[model samples]
Target: MLPGLFRNASRMYDCTSRVLQHYEALYRLVGIPEKEMMHSIMKNSKFELFLMKVVQQKVVTGLIPLLNHISKSNIEVDLQEVFKRFTFDNSCLMVLGFDPISLSVEFPKRTYEKAFDEIEEAILYRHIVPKWCWKLQRWLQIGQEKKLRKAWDAFDRFLNQRIASKREQLLSREKTHLEEAKFDLLTAYMMQEEIVNMGVCSKSNKILRDTAFNLIAAGSDTMGAGLARFFWLIATHPSVEMKILKEIKENLMVKDDKKEVGVFRTAVKADTLPSGHHISANTPIIISLYAMGRMEEIWGEDCIQYKPERWISEQGGLISVPSYKFTAFGGGPRSCLGKAMAFIQMKIVATSIIWNFHFEMVEGHPVSPSVSVVLHMKHGLKVRITKRSV
Candidate 1:
């Protein structure tokens, strides 16, 4: 049975037959086949220009102000929360053509943000409980299922409001000739609908809503959690951190340096595996990327250790690993479309933070992985920040 969170819609996580066809149509407008579309988008001048502008604005207006406040206060801060806010703002701006300004020195609480967390927790709950149990709860409108329903409503309201505002803005821009140079994901999708006559605009709204929800959901927390783990790892491994700093300084003349743990997919048809295992159609498969990353066969004896050198060659270039072996971002046709965008954002944030501040973990603070859809810190990454002399 499908989880309440997804329902019957063909979202990014859904494996319905129409999902591929929809993605293919969208991919065509961007001038690339489905398989190669993401890579091409990363290289597209318009997209790159848009991303750069958004990142720069966020760094200056959101990240720097907050970091400065934390540094001046000299109090321990949860780096995870900070990262989450930063990514959330960026995701909204890139996907919806608007910024909620969630990342700030004030650390304001956002209803939609909390709703996303609740939705995710409920999704995980559905996975652990028996299918019938969750379905019963869903039908009765109680427990995690109730919370999921509420969160879903809040999420839908948030998106619908934004979509309406965007439509109005587009119409105004057409008459006024005040159009932006870059189109956000939502704007692009809406334009595609109009140009291609995919369906009635009203019916297409649900598809647009789902697409926006999926992109923001996929981009925000995953990047936030990954960066949180990255910083914690670097903080604990001083030697690796120093090496990164050295590389950043020597190579860039200033500055500094820098998943979903599993991939879940449903088999579309009955197939026999290369490893001789057989599964029926619609069998769900979960590839443990966390386990894969730690395997000695995949990453050598030092696989368990956090070593920056593992990814570097003797010639000081990045070592190339096939996507199948290094499956952090998944492998094959359904690999993450945001992989390149994620790296670019990570580099910008990491370099800025490392170059400007030094982080120290709070004494006696415990750092461990949380049990959730995304591998976040059980206890958030608490640390104090000091401004760097440079």
Candidate 2:
């Protein structure tokens, strides 16, 4: 309940880390399903309002420009195409505050982006069944066992390298030893110069790597898919789009003087081969995803039906929606620490396309939920995007 920036950030950080720790044991712990923590955090907590502000600001600020540009470029992207990268970008930023440039239209090789994909696929394989089952398979050199073993080893290699690299970077830069002792979680964790008495912490690094990867895997894809669904609903529902656009034109639009929304290409890093923008705490984006769903009045009969009018107030003003009813970032003791961070990438990708493009299902694009750690479109969200006239 602390007010202003940094108000509850420290507390939030503590809880986030705890949740991360709990996730390390998720596979071993039963009855606790994958992604259950995220749902429990959002649906069953008090920080709902705080979560929404973070997500909404991210959309309105960080993501909008990039989306707008993409839509304007005569490019084509299906639902699956968008969500895959959309969620990937959001997840990476949330986990490491480092943005992969692949999401950008100008991205070159896709190294960092592919690395994330590899990590995600590996996480999914471990969770569907039990760890012993995987080991059992490895003992026999079974079908996927080889691939799984290789993937597991590769994943560890990547994390250890990253942890070591970050440590070296910190040592070189902070030589003065006079700078603030404050360091983000990753740096602090990597700087454990003292070796532990047991391998408990060392073995646990694999889980840390997996859990960090899961943050992107679970948080990014699910939210990205949800955003895509929201956009599909809004775009297909003209009345809904009108109301949202109206609110933007009235409440958020600027005249010739106010700086137009900055194109977010700079928000994501542009160089570095497989490039991504560096997302920082300084310009965090708020997702406001739940509000997109909770405005019953604007949507009417079934605001739940993807109607946009629900976003407009009864008096035609841009209305406020309660975070608890609409919260996607979640609330209470363990809301997503990267909630605002996720919002920036998600909103930009979603809003830009919603405002300018209409997607049509490909001849026989199947739409079913792939039940796993995150909600994936069973057959991928395939569609054709047609630009809306200016």
Candidate 3:
């Protein structure tokens, strides 16, 4: 879906390409510092910073601030919980142009959390059950199909209302104040290929909706799940946890190290790294996200070990990680837009939790994948956190 969305139209988007090229097209645009806008639909560059500022300013501006608000309130919960809901809400706004405010603690709602989980469960069912069986069941409203139908209704009603509202706004006689409003793919589709214009939008609103929802649905959990697992690995493995802490201390000041949850600095140089601290160089992430955790290349002989030093170079920064070596976020034309966002957020969250708290697993707790498009832990991440003074 991501490859189809972006690959064919890349040549046509030469103008946007040239602009990003001017900033250094490394995709991993290195040692260069600049403002970065993370969007899942970045696959096409249609939503590049230029297009997004023009098309999605309201929604984009709303997201990080909303994340900030969520961060402030969810101190008791895991960072994944807050960031996942924040990204989910933001992705919905980017595609659908509204917020469900799932991150709001006191809101009158079951929260978007359950809705996200239900969609995850239903998707899993599709994988395990025969397609015909599931289809028939969906039609008949029996068993999990009935549950799935309810989710479909929840999703459809939400989408239909939002789509209808946007259509009304577009059809009104007054000119579209697109600059002031959220510039989402929905609006992009509406304007670009109207029945009179090119026939893309007018021929199929449902397809457009599906495209937008595809972006929303695919992005939400992959990032959140990766961070959750990364931290869980850190918390569970004392040696690896110690290494990451030492790495952090190498680059950070005593005061900086002491800061509470979410004290994030840019990826900066440590004044020095000890000589023995060698990292595997220029490797891409393993393509299978799970395969990454098990790869000897990614984590050395102790492939299953949770070693942050494996990601560190004796020379500091990342060890010249190539795009394809590790599939932590897929590879090639289908690479994740949320990669940088997840890394930055993970470092912040991991740093805070590890620095400020000591966590221990509850014995015999079940941790299995939630069986979604992305790998999320089912039954939640169960652990105990106690404040750490040092």
RMSD after CA superposition, every candidate: 7.7, 14.5, 13.7
- Of candidate 1, the 10-residue stretch with the lowest lDDT total is 1-10
lDDT of 1: 0.70
lDDT of 2 by residue, 67-168 (tens): 556556645455555555645654444344344544554534464555544544544555456779877777986756666556556655655665555445
State which candidate, 2 or 3, has the greater lDDT: 3
The true-versus-predicted C-alpha distance at residue 349 of model 1, in Å, is 0.5
Better of 1 and 2 by lDDT: 1
TM-score, one value per model? 0.85, 0.56, 0.60
* Model 1 pairs whose backbones collide: none
Candidate 3 clashes between residue pairs 3 or more apart in a chain or in different chains: 55-183, 284-325, 284-326, 285-325, 285-326, 285-327, 286-326, 286-327, 287-327
Name the candidate that leads on lDDT.
1
How accurate locally, in lDDT, is each candidate?
A: 0.70, 0.46, 0.50
| Tens-digit lDDT track of model 3 for 268-333 | 333322445433443221123455446676556886643445555576545545544554444565
Candidate 2 positional error at 44, Å:
22
Better of 1 and 2 by TM-score: 1
The runs of at least 3 residues in candidate 2 whose Cα sits more than 4 Å from the true structure, single-residue gaps closed, are 1-75, 104-135, 174-211, 256-304, 307-335, 340-364, 386-389
| Cα lDDT tens digits for candidate 1, 259-302 | 00045667899999877999999997766666766788877888
Off by over 4 Å in 1: 1-43, 174-178, 198-203, 254-261, 269-278
By lDDT rank, best first, the candidates go 1, 3, 2
